[model samples]
Target chain A: MAQYELYRRSSLGMALTDTLDELITESHIDPQIAMKVLAQFDLTIAEALHNRVKAKAAIKGHLHVYRFCDDVWTFIVDRPTFKLEGSETVHADRIKVVACTARAPPGGKPE
Target chain B: MSNQLVPSVYTYVIDEVCEKVAPTFAEMGVGQNVLAELRQTWKRKIASMRVADFDFKESFDDGYGVYDGAGGQYGTEYYGGDHNDSSFAAAANLAALASGVGGDGTAPDSYHIPQNDGAGDEAQAETSKVVETAQPSQREIDELVQRLWQERHRAEGEAAEEQGRGSLAKQRIRQLDGVDDDDDEEDEDDNEDGIGSDLDDEDSEDETADVSHIILCQYEKVNRVKNKWKCTLKDGIITVNGRDYVFNKAQGDFEW
Candidate 1:
């Protein structure tokens, strides 16, 4: 199961991701909690490059996912290239390969 | 939003998105360069104009979303005022009561809730923002890590905290749940084997484990000094430096 967080975003589609040196994505599902809650959902992560089937165009290094809906995009990825500042990597942030996951309610199953 | 061009990093927009390529860029994780490739600075000036008419409700699944007495998919966030007043735990508890996922938030006959916490399908799903990210480590890897880490701790004589070594919630997840059939039996076996740390009532604290929140319980570290080398006895086979050594736990020593 993916973790959930209250994220502040711009209407144009950007989280105040680096506000006060915090990545908004980190606030989503906790990496450990994700294991049990997200076991059922089918998931995939394709690199943006060399894959034409992921989206309408090309994106480099972006993860390719086959979600039932378009709404579930903002993933809880471990700060890949977006290097963190001091004390950021001190705790859980040091963990590698954190997966993003979220389970939807019954009513909103994608069409 | 476009004209703002507030320099920093970690920003995303759909207008700049090229479906196929964008998803790949998204995989690398967000950065200024990724955004540079995705969004042209020349067109960024229109961001403010583009967002002028942007509506929160427009992002919702439908005009008004419905809850199945379980989780509610309200679409992208619609945060207003100070949302910090409500915690995920509180929201989960409230949602459980409202949706009746588990009538009293108790462990029902099914393995609905991962741990004994009142959190079940509804609390675990609805309030949770179901973002579609890549799969992290596989279950096999998780188990192996758990096993190897435990073995390493034991070999190092750092097994005092036997109950709280790894993610206990993970060990409880039922691969094929629904009825309390074979999983229950396996759960019991796990409890006895000492592998399933949470099965024991003594390790209940592990249930309260919340790796989700930023305000975590930073346990005091015990920097102890000891010999780095150890004699490991595994499946009666102990590989040393490069040679196989015969380990005798009773004798508390090893022979080459």
Candidate 2:
């Protein structure tokens, strides 16, 4: 299955890349192995989020900009407020939302 | 909250990736030890980010205790008093070396001079000739030129220390010490302002543009009416206010 690579831009992904880079620099692993590891990460992160995470959130904002391209939607919101699972909330001056198509492509679902 | 679940979700991802990659590592004939090290390093790096309270105790015994102790100490003193003392000592040593070189001018050049006959005047003339030469016989000349460069550098350093104590010299010392938190804050503010002003510029075209706050997810549906919009996003990762949150679903409402 070809998992979405969206979450690879997260901090967790950045940390993994940094660790892999260190190992590559030390000659402990080849770049090919690192690529495999990252591919595995893409799969694992998607699955973990799907199966393990159950929390829901609500976001309210003023949409500054929105674009739909290449089967993805990008929204730029100003002064957004996110109401998380609990009563807790988070506020930010601005946030960019990148949403890929949720429908699984044919033959792309994980077994 | 969704942010509270981030630590466990990240932990699960790390563990699952490590376990799943084992067969590939074995097929490639790479040692399993390297795979284990990769797992440890990945966990350590993520933990260091301090985004959430990650439970590293379950994976390995040697991970959390030592890391927490060392990291705590580093965060407390490494930037405050200890670093200042070390940098001050280093600057003092540099000043002493400069003074030593200045006080005994012939000391640095003594070893560079060839051991000629004990004729002081002739040896001096020989040294002058060596300095004047631009030929392939450059070992001695190189050493003399290096000494001259060091002398010039020391002179410049002393001058900077004397005249630019509040501005250039202190800033240099602060840079060396890596303790300029105010400067870093100012830099971040400037960057944010720059990004805000150029929000409509071509730089926003990149999918992975460096926006400070972002959400990456898959959308189930997005409906709009007039100026109102609603989106149902799934498997989303949200980063806002320097914190990370993950959710299975998010309902967003906004108006253009």
Candidate 3:
């Protein structure tokens, strides 16, 4: 998890690695929570992408924020994941940037 | 009393839900195919939206099945109100064609079912499908690309040997294998049918220039297009519009 960075310049030129660094280190977002969220993402759409009974959106988002091409996709997990050091539990919101190499279907929303 | 939630019960309830919802929904002019396609599309959409561990263990038109393990089972075929059994992507591809959204013009025919001609029976085949959902890693992509490249060269070499030399087979092998691009350049000039002219290098280009022109650039991680023409993890290569392009499992990018 530590070895995997959220890809440099992810989400249309957004500095994802640098931003993740700030969110985790400077902004004090828990590392465990953040990575877990990303891992979930990797497991879901990122994973199972290469093959399917159907052609899946390699990148699919329900909550489309049409603002920044740099807008980070984020959502909180429902169940408790990791226990914080002080008996507090953490459920990090999974996050990713839309930088799909696949072109969206015509009239389809931009990544 | 707790054990009352039998796997069959779960299966029955979902079957009942579809049996009820589909017909009523069809009354509004939504055909069974569109309804089911939309159903699966939304199912996937909702699944993608979730940030937690969630599984509906859905009762699809073919049957109901549990995930991470196999327990519950049901078939909508037996309890049908409206049954249009095409996968969402396939059905939607058809719909897109009808609506002028663009598609391959394929009529919806083949749906995903286990091929029984394999060395396994139905259960074994279904298990294989369950296994395929795992995400492909970079290692897998690399191996596939390398293997495809090797396979192409090997097949070409075999054809070259079997078909004998001095014919167009040898020329194609030379082109695909990058052995001797300039060997037949003078002769190919006179043989101006453009039969094997794609091998000719117009200008001094890098190593990749010899190989088929990259039609599409596939990646391990899906993302929007980028600037660098650096090496990409191409899944497979195909000829489109007389030039070669690489493609991947991602559908609808086919510009043929």
Model 2 per-residue lDDT tens digits across residues B1-256? 3878988899889888999999998998889977877787678767767777777746554754554464354233533555544443443344456556456442344423332223453446466654454132335434545555587587666665667676587677768667577767776777665653455363454443345588988888999999999999888888887788898899999999
TM-score order of candidates, best first? 2, 3, 1
Q: Each model's DockQ?
A: 0.03, 0.60, 0.05
| Native-to-model Cα distance after best TM-score fit, residue B147 in candidate 1, in Å | 39
**Fraction of native A-B contacts kept, per candidate:** 0.01, 0.82, 0.05
RMSD of each: 24.0, 16.0, 22.4
Q: Which stretches of candidate 2 lie over 4 Å from their true place?
A: B57-61, B64-209
Candidate 3 wrongly placed segments (more than 4 Å): A1-96, A99-111, B1-29, B32-37, B44-50, B53-155, B161-256
Q: After superposition, how far is residue A47 of candidate 2 from its true place, in Å?
A: 1.0
Pitting candidate 1 against candidate 3, the one with the higher lDDT is 3
Instruction: Predict model 1's lDDT versus the native.
Output: 0.25
Query: How well does candidate 1 match the true structure in TM-score terms?
Result: 0.18
- lDDT per residue (tens digit) for residues A2-110 in model 1: 1122111121222112211122233332333223212211111111111111111100122211111232222111211211122221122211111111234223332
- lDDT per residue as tens, model 1, B1-256: 1111212111222232333334443554444443332233212322322423223224322323332112231112323212322333343344344334333333222221222243453455432322221112244334533544444444334323344357763444443354468768777777774664543442332233212311110011112124211111111111111111111110111111
- Tens digits of per-residue lDDT for model 2 on A1-111? 337777788889988998788678768789999999998888888888888999998999999788898878989887899998768889988888998887753336633
Cα deviation of B89 in candidate 1 (Å)? 19
Docking class of 3: incorrect
By the TM-score metric, which is better: model 1 or model 3? 3
Better of 2 and 3 by lDDT: 2
